[model samples]
Target: MPLQDNLSGYNSGGSDPSLFFLSGIPGLEAMHLWISIPFCSVFAVALLGNCTILYVIKTEPSLHKPMYYFLAMLAVIDLVVSATTIPKSLSIFWLNSREINFTACLVQMFFIHTFLSMETAVLLAMAFDRYVAICNPLRYTTILTNSMIAKIGLVAFARSFLLVVPLPFLLRRMPFCQSHVISHCFCEHMAVVTLACADTRFNNIYGIFVTLFIVGLDLTFITVSYVKILRTVFSLASKEQQLKAFGTCISHLCAILIFYTPVVLFAIIYRFGHQVAPHIHILLANFYLLFPPMMNPIVYGVETKEIRYRVHLLFQGKSF
Candidate 1:
């Protein structure tokens, strides 16, 4: 009934599948110290940038509108996502502390997936905000009131929590007869699930279903919303007004691309790149997780006039 015996085969003996070993760029363990430096820099920037976004939005009364509210929600989600993965990954890379307790790993996975889902929900809400603003300008304020924003935020949180709560349990129930060494830097859902010695057909199918129903559906709605916004913009009589209207969405669009493109790439590689280099897969996975949090604030700070103005004033020691 010992763990060593259980590792040979599932259900043969009782194994404490309660600990896992994390790896940092397999076959390049010697370079883990060097890798930690860039990762640390990225983490610092992500935290600082998201904090700045939160501060600017909170301080600048003009940014208290629905769009900026959604932006602030996004910053919060980015912060959660970054915090869930970066610290443990850094420890593994820098200190060679690669062992993680099963419960702690599950907790990390829960927060990561929950925040990711919330992010998609927030983006969908933002797209709706833009749609209403452009298509029904007169009712924008009335429709997306403070109360409505609160309701939407609650729904996003609830949806993410309800859906992802099953994932950790699902993983926990699986028999891990194989090695506990995870090939990636973090405890991603698919990465952890793939380690189970039992057949993972159900887990794989469920993961794909969640992706299609939750993330894919949000993307579909966001795209349709943007198409409608574009039509509305083109219908404007004044060219300048049309340009101004379209410009407002550039930041959100860029943020969407930054977040989703890497994700889609990682998913594709996970499914079809069985023959690809292990390092390539590891690097892409880390990039997808870290890139958005680090770049989102930079995109918003530069693209949004109000945020840019507030940032400039903050740097100049001027009052808002």
Candidate 2:
């Protein structure tokens, strides 16, 4: 459909929108410009930070371990997530800014979910790595071999790909009889689904079920793994082992909290709170997407002494 005639339903006086597929909100040009600065900054940082981590791990043989492998995987996924969103975001800033074609919107939704699920899987893998190191230290080498790490990375990527692909397809099949203008900046799945013209009973239920399955399942597994880890830590023979184990995990825990809490809180406020400032919600939503990339390197660099030293050496080399 032509853009002008396709978008002629902004004044129908009904609460619903006019399109049949997932379209972004209108009138976000200024807001899009405002967000582009931070989005670009974070994108550059995530790319550099993750690339540097990958480089340091690749160059330094001593740092070639299971933990760093998973960290590198995480950096790669963060880079993917940031890259997926930023260009579309920049497009929004330059173009009419709200006219996301149905096809491109679906692609964005796919990658967003894929990277998010991948991050969850990576975190679970990290937790399992911690579990082995803390709870089964004697067999850490045998347990997390290079082949095992490779397999785990493959499985994580595969599962994320499988889970995320189905959702965008399901969404694409739905008829968006209503709103074209998504209230939020990006083409988030729920925000997109809510604009569907057909009955969204299935979409809403599926979204909730998937949320419970992916995020809920990952959160459950992570909690159980950490509980076991905490138990093992307390039973350690020396304070040094205990402290070392605790220090290694503190950053992951912090990252998890920082990433998940805003999402949960946003869900609650959007569903229940009546007075949510659109700007506040928009900022928080952007934070939900951007903050983790910013925090990942900082958390790892600060928490892991090895990574810290590696970063320092990189900087020192630059100085020389």
Candidate 3:
């Protein structure tokens, strides 16, 4: 775990809970309201941007394609990601309401992890979409039809759901006797698990397995897709053609970095940086979740030609 627990070992078997108290950050409670201002601003932008993406993609028939369909799915996941944690976190920051029921905490934890895995899978699916479009241009439509897209979506959801639904149940059997105060604003899995009195190796090991299998494999496939994409792109005869081919992938590349960089950083910190302060971990954890939702639509809106045009017309009050 990235967070350091000063009182972890003593609480052996006494778990009593009407609630678990959440914190914005352990030591920076005094500045939570100030901290929330930017958080709230980001949330607002995410809400508006993703909603715009959904609306634009849905309203424009020209925008309907496998690529745009994946973008719409990404937008929806971003909305769910924001909707899951931000409101409760804001409540803790603004209203000084920190108590979350045990069951509610479990639910929050479940959504957080589940959606994170789903995002990885979605990104992987998008990578595959790009792969087929670039490598098999003539057959792209045949390869990624609506039925295939639906199946892909279902697989992503099932993979994430099966992997993450166990996390809350794993914690449910453990007794949280150490302290009711969760070290972060939401019920992060390790944060909640650390307060447990029972042996937690099973939960911890399962977490490691999930990370390795899902993120590791997803990133591996994404890398392979991009490599093949680059090969086909460079094989183009003209420099202009090459640039155009590569340009189409820029937005997705940005999204890949935005989503995976934090996961990589967190993995390093979790495994090797246990000496770091809880406040720092909390801040980074919150920022990790915030950046993607806030940035994804912005990235696509600017880098995607059709979306940019649609957004322009929308702002100018042009009819869809």
Candidate 4:
């Protein structure tokens, strides 16, 4: 059946939908103000932490290696993820302004998905960076040159943008005859599409395909890289050298865990946890988006000596 015909039965009224209402937290209206406080704090920390990482990376010449370069990219992705969701979420919580224009919602969804895909790609690239540094130390610099880094960055951005560009249009074509109320804090693609009156099989299928092909593939590569890294580390002659080599990966591994674990969990819950409480789904959705940006910088700052040193210098008012 044709999509428009399938949606023709839906009573969309005479006017096309122009705005969407975001349900911040169902049945917890009284606690929204209190809720916004911690959310605001987390958002602030994420912004400060990521911005600081970017500033330190930009100012410090010695931190211009492939690993740090990937870190910088990850910082940018974190910033994008935070920015796309937090401010509007704060507005929804504090000011009670929940109506988002159709165009703005589409824009937000595009960037969120784009940057998320880019983040996975960046993490994969970082894993590859670690693999080279640990397994092929002598050729690390030669392999991951400035040009190569730029190419990787370009490819990541392009892949994400191309893959997600169709999503907004797909949603736009659907007739949202059901309530225009998004049940989560931000403008998630699935949340928006679920309101459509027409068959959303294509959307669901495409979403899963993107998840499996783009994100799943990245996860597989990262796991393989780490497995290889572990093999190489175990074969080292000295325990000190083994520990030292593994130490460099601690931050990246922590980052991978923080970013991917919640994402997978949320996906599982969204797919199979239909009986779960609405608040559980809502909270998990928010956490999946918020926690990584807030925690990634802290993890990297504490685990990476170079970043820590540079951050310390900045706090001491010393030039990098």
RMSD of each: 3.6, 4.0, 3.8, 5.1
lDDT, ranked from best to worst: 4, 1, 3, 2
lDDT of 3: 0.87
Return the TM-score for candidate 3, rounded to 2 decimals. 0.94
- Name the top lDDT candidate: 4
Tens-place lDDT digits, model 1, residues 1-320: 43224334323322555777777687777798999998999999999999989998898888899999999999999999999999998997877777788789889989998899999999899999989989999999999999999999999999989988888999999978767877778888888887887988988888788877888899999999999999999999999999999998999999889989998999899889999999999999999888999999999999998899998998899999
Candidate 3's clash total is 0
lDDT of 4 by residue, 1-320 (tens): 43233234222431447777777876676789999998999999999999999999998989988899899999999999999999999997898877788889999999999999999999999999999999999999899999999999999999999999999999999987657777778889998888888999999999889878998799899999999999999999999999999999999999989988999899899889999998888889889899999999999999999999999999999987
Overall lDDT per candidate, in order of appearance = 0.88, 0.76, 0.87, 0.89
Q: What does candidate 2's lDDT look like per residue over 51-140, in tens digits?
A: 888888888888899989998888888888788777766665656445566777788888888888888888888889888888898999
User: Model 4 reaches what TM-score against the true structure?
Assistant: 0.94
lDDT of 2 at 233: 89
Question: For candidate 2, which ten residues in a row score worst on lDDT?
Answer: 13-22
> What's the best-to-worst order under TM-score?
3, 4, 1, 2
lDDT of 1: 0.88
Model 1 TM: 0.93
Please provide, for model 3 over 1-320, each residue's C-alpha lDDT reduced to its tens digit, 9 standing for 90 to 100. 31223123222222445567776688887789899999999999999999999999999999889999999999999999899999999998888777678999999888888888988999999999889988899999899999999999999999999989988888888877657777788989988878887889998899889989998899999999999999999899999998988888999999999999987887788778899887878888988898899999999999999999999999899987
Per-model TM values vs. the true structure: 0.93, 0.87, 0.94, 0.94
The 10-residue segment with the lowest total lDDT in model 3: 2-11
Q: Candidate 2: where are CA atoms >4 Å away? A: 1-32, 94-96, 318-320
Considering only N, C-alpha and C atoms within 3 Å, which residue pairs clash in candidate 3?
none
